[model samples]
Target: MSDPNPSPEAFRQMASEYIEVANRQGQDAYVGAVATAMLHAGARYAAFVAASNSPNKTQMQLSRKTNLDQITAQFRTYLEGHYDEHSENYDSYIKR
Candidate 1:
């Protein structure tokens, strides 16, 4: 079984792996497209997890909005933090 809660280092490592894969897609893949794919994959996986953890279809249906809200809120927070961090180096990043 996977750890219920991974350490911060482990979380960063996982994120790095995803970034590596996105980078490996080469110049042909637009950054926006890659980001969209990642977002879709995250939402798909979250839905699967929610369904798996629910006792039944009715429970899953009942909790769908709450689950979605929680996931999106977490994503918003993380995105905002990272956006701020990157904004500090926007010029250098844009030049790359």
Candidate 2:
């Protein structure tokens, strides 16, 4: 399916609905859902930056490839280190 390009208000509403559903599943579920959402958001943000600022098609592709690699590495690092000395705070990983 094609991704929906939601308006800011629509995005807020969808987030609220997702939060409600996640809340019903308990804290861990909510945290996991939020973490997943953040990972996707980071990727989308990177893609947007790559698309918007690159001067040409070749540069755009290069930017996107580099951004994807960096984001994936960062996400993997976050996942691996998230439980160390900071298992109590998901924000620590998010902040990274």
Candidate that would win on lDDT: 1
Q: What TM-score fits each model?
A: 0.90, 0.45
Clash tally, candidates in order: 0, 0
**Candidate 1, overall lDDT?**
0.90
lDDT of each: 0.90, 0.71
> Can you tell me which runs of candidate 2 are displaced by over 4 Å?
1-29, 87-96
How well is each residue in 47-83 modelled by candidate 2, as lDDT tens digits? 7866776788888776766777876787788577755
| Whole-model alpha-carbon lDDT for candidate 2 | 0.71
Lowest lDDT 10-residue stretch of candidate 1: 22-31
Candidate 1 lDDT over 1-96, as tens digits, reads 899799999999999998898877646788889888888898899899999989999999999899989988999999999999889989987775
